[model samples]
Target: MTDEPRLSAQDMIERLGPVLSRRTRIRAVTALLAGVAGAVFVGTLWWSEPGPLPGRTHLAFALFTMFCLTWAGYGGWLVTRRVALFATDRVIAAWIGLAASLATTAVIIVVAVQRGTSVGLALVVGGLFVAVALVLAVRAHARRAALLRRMHELSGREER
Candidate 1:
């Protein structure tokens, strides 16, 4: 007979809840910090520029904070499930990077067109975000290859 004790589904879930919650505390705190930092960064930038355009920046920051919180929640869920995170995380990171790049780029373009300004710091920052997104794409591709190799090994299949 196996030495393990049998547990009902409900019992298993109930027991796991506290354990998962403990495991997720660090992730939750990190996400919260990131969200606050992002908001503060945006707010500071807006404060420096005394103009009506700051409203748009505030809106953008709000969107960013919402995205960060949602991403954090997803990460916590992943931890709670005790899933291997590397493969899944890369795709999510790439998606987030792409979204940030696109959103920032759009904001820069719209602001430039509307305000007839050039060489602003936001434009430079947006360019940097694009570069970061490119890096994320490359990293995600590498992680995917690694994941496939691991799966092949686990399945006792020879890799081509």
Candidate 2:
């Protein structure tokens, strides 16, 4: 083995630069803004209704509000956390995001159809979400593969 010393945690972190990248920061901000805006809009609408709504309507409003709040909380947690995400973590996160996007799209389309609303608009929005998620997933997988390749190359060199 070579006599080169191993990198310390601080050195490794310095070499990696900022763990919370610009893209991640932007994503967290977007999620927070969207979630808070959605929650506020739904809450206001529910509160300002003229007449007494059905139990099912109230339940729906509550569920939607909670969902928005949950997303906001997740965003807030991500923003506050200082942990660095590894390649495997990124891959898992990307998959989770893809699943969530697909589920959300399905729900939107189903709701639009059930309500006799403009299914076209719903489909367009859902398509956009799915496309974005797919792109992110692909990028994540590529990044992981590149990292793994680099790791193997470095290890091979160390052995020699």
Model 2: CA > 4 A from native: 1-4, 8-16, 54-67, 87-100, 115-121, 148-160
Output the number of the lDDT-best candidate. Answer: 2
Count of backbone clashes, every candidate in sequence:
0, 0
Query: Which residue ranges in model 1 land beyond 4 Å of their true spot?
Result: 1-29, 36-58, 119-124, 157-160
Give the Å error, residue 7, model 2: 1.4
Residue 63 CA displacement from its true place in model 1, Å: 2.3
Taking the tens digit of each residue's C-alpha lDDT, what string does model 1 give over 27-142? Answer: 54565567556656655665676657666777676667666665566555545555434356556657776886878688777877779777467777888888888888888889
lDDT of 2 by residue, 16-60 (tens): 867788888887778778889999999999999989997656767
Residue 144, candidate 1: how far off, in angstroms? Answer: 2.3
| Model 2 TM-score, all chains together | 0.59
The true-versus-predicted C-alpha distance at residue 70 of model 1, in Å, is: 3.1
Model 2 weakest 10-residue run by lDDT: 84-93
